[model samples]
Target: MRMAQTPAAADGSSGDGALGRVPPQSIEAEACVLGSMILDAMAIDQVVQILHDDYFYRPAHQIIFRCLVQMRHESKAIDLVTIKEDLVRRDLLEKIGGQDYLVALAEGVPTSANAEYYAQIVRDKALLRQLISVGTQIVRDAYETQDEAPIVVDHAEQSIFEIAEQHIGDSVITLQDLLRHTFEMLEQHEGQLITGLASGYTQLDELTSGFQKGEMIVLAARPSMGKTSLLLNIAENMAVIDQAPVAIFSLEMSRNQLAERFLASHARFNLRQMRRGVITPETWTALQTAAGTLETAPIFIDDSASLTVIQLMARARRLKSLHDIQCVLVDYMQLMLYSGRATSRQEQITEISRGIKALAHDLEIPVIVAAQLNRGPADRPTHTPRMSDLRESGSIEQDADVVMLLHNEDYYHLGEEGYQPRGVTDLIVAKQRNGPTGSVPLVFLKDYTKFESATFGVEQPLGEPMADAPF
Candidate 1:
């Protein structure tokens, strides 16, 4: 013979009944959580961090648990007597069925050892409830608003992202755990050739350790200083050589234009010749080989001209989910728009920089962003860029983990006697949070619009002169 089921139990509804249908509640799990907390005072330390009062399915349980948390927060004991007194002082004792129900709760659990298990069940149900709430709000907004479809979609994405972040519990790690993980990584890297991703440039990789994860690296330079070319070089190296997935957000150039530059760089041919359809047989053969190589490369490009930071984050998240992109490169920072309304350009840039940094941290990947330096570098005697020369310097310099400025001596010392540093460029590491700051010498191939590692021999001019160079 079986006992009859209560109305609430049969319908899986809470006391409030406001949810209408079952809204993903776990009453038994909630009772176990409370029982564990009351049974063992020390169990509150763990359960308190995992759950809050609102997670309870019943209003009475919510009231009781709220009292328990308040008592614990004030360094009070968490036993039955102390919790009852705390509830009484707050006038919630009778509301929660008084001392009798509290005693029943403690007696309901077999032991407090399974507290974490019960808490997990409660958390999962809470997450499902939050999802339902977010879905309901999205539906409401869709029906009530006459806004653009993309704007509504962005709102929905932002809401879901917030809920996802909230559900990412227990992110904190102890120092001992970090140290152990670091030691294991070092042990694995002991006899390995390279630890981080290879930049394909020996000296630059030596300096940067190949753009570590969760780092925001800012590559800034004046116009025609080969910033875009250097970014493309790194992208090609990572995608084609290492077979890593790479995403490039080109705010300035078209996808086909970027492809043309890549072919010229890869085949060591003149970009102008390819653009003008004046290729020789050898050049055509090399072009065909470069095209084949690129066709198999793991690279993705988005050439949206007026992209906002919010849109960029949404797209990057999608790419990360769909393709597992290992690295991301934004063509330039100044072209990115701030999603929020700003009173000045500086404010907009600050918001954009902060948002990019947040995106890098959230995705746990390296984000390389190109920026333009102010004219202050040109006015200086040496024409070397400083951290202050970064346009909208305040936020960018503060948020970037590493700031690299590109300088071409050939661009500044044009037509000077004995000034033959043609195709020579300096990658000034002006700011590095975890490493030394210095210059990494590189060679800029003028004709192909590419950058390569500087070799140790007598420097020879390659390809066409700077007069006909297209940036």
Candidate 2:
């Protein structure tokens, strides 16, 4: 006849298809049903998908399976009341303890009952759940082997409409899902379709949502052209206002110097007064408030004078995993060197660029690596830097998805009064791979070490060009 079912098989059958197999007598006492579904081995999403069109479950029957899924996902015991209410919502079982007491009771689920209830339900739905139990065993084995977070690799060349099929050879979604998923796919890629990540500049945000994640965005300028200030502005925009974590890798300046400069910019205090001493109450209050705001801001600063490429990658990974860093701000590129290998300056920089790009892709975050333009630009009459003018343009441009060269006319020419902007640095978006390449005029505050969006007569869409092409 049929093979004899073990006591554990009781985990798969309840009353020969009654309400979830009522919690078994105990973990030791299992049912003798021939085939039981363990469900313990499935992905939470897979479990949900498996039960999407369950012909047998009336909301109540869904509870036990759901409880099992939750337990596996959380690695914790399930709450009975929550499960009960979910059942009640489907008109499966009479509202446990009425709808009023339902929530409170759900909040107080005992572990033994939760585990047993889920297991017992599996017993009742044995035939329908065999795969789940098998999956559970597989998952247990995998988890035992890997202590780190599981890396899920999507080999599908096309990101859109990627279908997920179950073990039984049944596709869960159809043509409708494909269409909806296309729109949703675009929604997921919002940052990639736009430029700069900060939301502070309304127009800039409109032009480019922010810098795309997994990209190397260079912000380059000469010695005193508000490069650091522009950096602080972006940090403030992303980390402060938009609430995105931004990392700053400062090689040239100390932590204190960067802070002092940022404070001077927002506080509007003379750099000499703020630095040399003589702090007024208003200025002190402003400094204190700025400090307080920055205290909780997700702006990570590494003012390491001798930061190596490998060390930077290590730090960036640590930040991406722990601090949830979304964007990177490297003060200047030339200052960075490779620590792991020995090579010439060009080789070192080449390795550094490769490492930075890899870091961005690995972390799936935008990396803003600023750089220094060569003397070629300085030697030019107008002093506008070309892509070749970048200190190490070959490696930098090759690795970068977007290369931006910041140019401020006022910084180069001091004499012109009206055109000479005291508080503006125009950000030149010299190159863009995904869309049209053009200059975006961004205001640079020399004092605050920040960049702000300057609204113009017309707001051009991302693919269009602006009229004032200063760069």
Candidate 3:
């Protein structure tokens, strides 16, 4: 067996004391990982996902590992003889201490079972070294004084986030592993319960099996089609009925306005009458009860008027960390500002769409975003919106796991014959990545600014005020 070379001390000192060092590393862990891979040919399969060539502290180990990985990729045997022959073919065998070192590595490991554990140690130390590099760059940027503080800070945060993501390690799952997880999920969901977070609407829940985690749902509609109202209704259902913590980013409405709509919806009172302070005694009692219910619901609202997608992600992360929010709702994506350096409006919208999808994936939560449709529906005869009519860009439709279009037949045929289906709204599920697409009927209560199941007959509320409602 070849003799192993001892690495210099990490701290920059001779035999005496030292102060500054390069970065944190574990040479022993790197050697153990290499030794394990050399001991058992199949051990490379277990550690290959965790350790890359750069993870090795020793250059010879890095070269040896690279050769092993290439051999494995090519479906070749990974014993010391094959590895040495391949390295010799590339004139790297002598550079990496020849066949004797390979023999030494194979003989050093006690067992191949701890290969993954040793690889993890190497990976963690490599991550620390990367973090130190990022920190050093950040400090240098801080002292340069060329850029604005906020810009520097943003750059630093982004760099750190990228490092953290890299250190999250191999997320690739074999089909066998994935199937095992799927079987577990199926067994756990063997009962009558929905597999995902319940939307609280029986028909929609049945259609979607509830909104699955890491999904992006796009709800689109033209003006006055009650998309926001529908979003609020779902949020209400999830938060109040399911007791799931929800965070709402209302770019188009204020907190008070959203709260007022929620109160009106919950209390079954006319929003206009409540706003004008003309509610009856029974309405007052209902409003009091509704307020009490909503006061206890785990619903959080952020009504930032000029929120950018970056700011929204930061806020969503904070909400997730602090409140453990189960779902996120962004009211009207078109109103949100795109803080990225995209040139065109379409590019900006694309960035925003992609950002929200990434956020949902990163947080492993379902994100429901309300969007606006263009004037294509107005020109059409039936006036039903399609996925192509999504405003600004088509990326929103492409990024969404489910795309729903709200169409109010009443808006298009208000004065014609057999027109204006009172309180009836058609929620067209135009695109569903994992389910069937169809229309789910809903009742739009204009006075209360809410939506309910269409099975509830169109019965106007008692003591309806004859005034214009502001929504």
Q: What is the lDDT of residue 42 in candidate 3?
A: 85
lDDT of 1 by residue, 1-471 (tens): 111222343223543432567678887788788888888877777887788877776777777677777777788877888888888888877767668777878887778999988888988888888889889889999999877666788779878877776743465789999999988887976754355666788776766677888889899999989899999999999999999998999999999999999999999999998899998888789899999999999999999999988888889888887898988899899999765767698999998999889888887788999999999878988897777778864789889988888998678887788876656788877777766566778888889988888885332222232221111
Model 1 bad stretches (over 4 Å): 1-19, 69-90, 139-155, 167-176, 191-198, 276-296, 392-394, 416-418, 457-471
Q: After superposition, how far is residue 20 of candidate 2 from its true place, in Å?
A: 43
Q: Tens digits of per-residue lDDT for model 3 on 1-471?
A: 234543343212123311265466765677678888777778888888788888776777788788877887899977778877898899987776667767777777767889989899888887887888888889889998686554576578667766765744456779999999988888976763578888776667767788999999999999989889999999999999989999999988999999999999998899999899998888788899999999999999999999888787777877887899999999989998866667999999999999899889988899999999999999998787778889999899889998888988788876788654665787877777787666777888888988877886432221321121110
Q: Of the candidates numbered 2 and 3, which has the greater TM-score value?
A: 3
lDDT of 2 at 303: 96
User: lDDT by residue for model 2 over 191-239, one digit each (tens)?
Assistant: 5554447546655554455677798877777777767677777777777
Among the numbered candidates, top TM-score falls to 1
lDDT of 2: 0.59
Task: Indicate the TM-score of model 3.
Answer: 0.78
